[model samples]
Target: MAGVRDPGALTSGQRTVMAATITASALLFSSLTSISVALPVIQRDLGISSSALHWVIVAALLPLCALAVVSGRLGDVLGRRRVFLAGILCFGAGSVVCAIAPDEVLLVAGRGIQGVGVALAVPLALANLTSALPGHRRGWAIGVLSAVTTGVSVVVPPSVAILVHFASWRWLFVAFVPVTVYVFLAGSRHIAESPRAPGASMDVRGCLFIAGGLTLLVFAFERSSDWGFTNRQTLAPLAAGLLLLVAFARAERRATDPLLDLRPLVRSGVSVPLTALAFAQCAVIVVTVYVTLYLQQVLDLGTIETGLLMLPTSVGSVLLGPVVGRLTDRGAGHHLVLGGMTLLTVALLWLAVGVDHRHGALLVPALFLLGLAVPLVYPSAGALSLGALPASARGVAASLQIEARQIGATMGLALMSALFTAVEWDERNARLADPAEHFTADEENKLDTVLTEAEKGQALLARLPPAERRKVHDAADAAFSTALNTTLIAAAGLLFLGVLLALGVFHVPRRGRRRPGP
Candidate 1:
């Protein structure tokens, strides 16, 4: 394996590669937040339904989830630099399409195209960065990159808020094009092509199976809340996706040149990090979505304020990133990762049981801890997962981790939504059944019809008398808060499980050893 000539500093070329890849990541991640911030404007400008507006986000995620493994494997079979550049072209073209789009349909189509580019670029970018240096130093690079991107994710919202306030939402799509072009140009000149498998044939059937499976699964979960779990639309796709994934596994086992070689996943070091990362992704989507919902729906905070309030988590990530990286390089990654998971669990429990309007501002500390937890877990888990594999397998290894996180994110959304609805419904029903509540038949009927969690609060309150509204609103808020807290508790449990899994499965090097650690 090739090593960086200087252990202390990156060469000019390595720095260029790092900058281009990290910049590309910033571009991709920032788009999600920018679009989120601009969604209201987009809906008003396009005059689209609430349902249709969601497709703008879903379209991007689907292709990104589906194509990741294939893109990573293609990098190994073809060339990483070549594929990475092509991704830039696709992303830029898609941005142009979105910038010029006149309607929701075209915008969603453009987003899907951009998702394809993301699938190609993101995993390969990591593969390139880690491959640029020797194994021992990869942790620091991953840590810095994670911190930078996390910061970007937080920072983009405030800037996007300003941008959307002053300019048309279309500018959001156009704003990044120049940066994209620069990264493309810089990468073409500076990024070296990774080692490719000579004359290796693409596993066409395996690619089709996994892509089709993941796309279907993601679509099913993304739509499950809206369509209802028992609805035929949801069930049909969910069952089909599972079947296809099973077929994909079978196909991979038989293929001579598989798109995703599954053998590495059986190793304890690799599997533990991958699983832990998946759990972390689940925690992220769950906490972020529910917290945003809490801020907006319960407290009625505006988008900008809610975003700003979420900054402590981002701050913690930035503060701890470099330290986590240094610790990993020193063979302390095992302790850091498990400790991070434990912290995450504690933070989630803190929010779950204690969060309230009176003490809501105190959430800052817990959120800050949440921030600390991610930098500790993510970069370290990524380093461990990739480091466990051979150089030849690193591309696929990175892709596998990406795929797991994507699936985890989708599943997290589904799980939280499902659990919230169930808990909220039971809470509402138990109230309706109580004589102490003294609910009229009309109110009972109205409450009984409330299916979605959002409807339980404002929708019901809007129909009640001013005198009656406050009581119903309070009850609704309590239910919503209860549901939210329950979901957080569930997330906390998962993080605890992640900690246990890492401890049980992963065997770390002893302290005072000079050996490299995964």
Candidate 2:
């Protein structure tokens, strides 16, 4: 291993550390979401069967979610710079594997490798920024950093479409090569090692238990879309995963070197801020998922068209981010968070009421507003989550906060899906009951499929009598629209709840000398 080169001097102080860390984190986070937009083309090129598509996308995410805490803990115990560099190396290597893979299996394997890399790097990146920057600038720095992280959600989707169109889909992975290399070389040289607890040791057993449990938990959430929640496939893994997680929590209390300091896990200070941010995150991700669907499936737009429509959100994020950060820096963190989350709540409610087949343009302002809101809430929330922590606790706090966000997004997806399914079922059954319409189980499945894939659906519907076909099509649209509406309302309610929590519960970190002696 490269001995720590004059990293303190290399950083050139906080300004360079801030710039390098933000750039590195953006690339890492963007890589996580970029694959989604390119998946269809990837599916076609790899001859990936429809059944395997989920795995292709989930491959990287699984490790990313599962290993997050473990990576953060390792950073705390060892040195942040060393662990951070190792992550860059792993991410770079994984990108190479992904770019060169010749078949579906190898591609999925490569993705998993990339996920591991992200897990290791992401938590430490923010922790470095927090520890490096001075106190007053901390919130602003974290907010701007959070803005960059959140921008990935708005930016990656549209960007991927353009890249895939002009260049091969492989270039998506290839593109990461130079960026990852630069971060590895420059970040390793510049970023300083964070303060480590003397004689701090890792809880290897606890890490294994947590890692195992998290992997299973993510698997359950990932598979729930395909395998219904009631199915044994979903229930069995979920039950076992929760049990293992419980065991991990118990282990943390007793272990000498706990993966997470158990005190914060139970404290209102940590839980409340984390809970509030998680809900807001849940709201934003659902917007990304369902809004894209409404534009494509409902408005009947193509991939490139949908991509273009979504560009305003990214533009808004880039333009508005620094302002939010500045506001937070001026000790307006709470107000900005409240205002930002309120915008999210309003945007979602607007989406619920206003979205229809003809009004794709209405989405532009709502999405821009959504993008604008993210900076307000997340950076402030991140600052709140980590600001008062001892250097070592910052890693656990950072990773745990990340894990909460991922879990929130997972839960939100499952909640929306269940609600959508229930609403769709009732609406569809009401239509199917008409005696003149005779859709068999097969025909019913085909009709549902058409909502997502219009061209193939239209061909199948042509086999039906023209009069019956139009009713069926319109009913399908109505059912989908209703389900989407209800889901948005639910998302809005969750965000509002987060707003309340942020107002009432998120207090500044308490000062203390709590680290155990060497």
Candidate 2's residue-wise lDDT over 19-138, tens digit each? Answer: 778887887877865665565566546655332444554566666655776776688788888888888888889899999999888998888888888888877888887888767778
Q: Model 2: how far is 17 from its true place, Å? A: 9.5
Candidate 1: where is the Cα deviation over 4 Å? 1-22, 33-58, 76-82, 96-108, 124-151, 165-170, 184-197, 226-232, 354-359, 386-396, 421-479, 506-518
Per-prediction TM-score, please? 0.76, 0.75
Best by lDDT: 1
- Name the runs in model 2 displaced over 4 angstroms: 1-23, 35-59, 75-86, 92-110, 124-157, 166-170, 178-200, 218-228, 315-320, 329-331, 356-358, 387-396, 421-476, 503-518
Among these predictions, the greatest TM-score belongs to: 1
**Number of clashing pairs per prediction, in order:** 0, 0
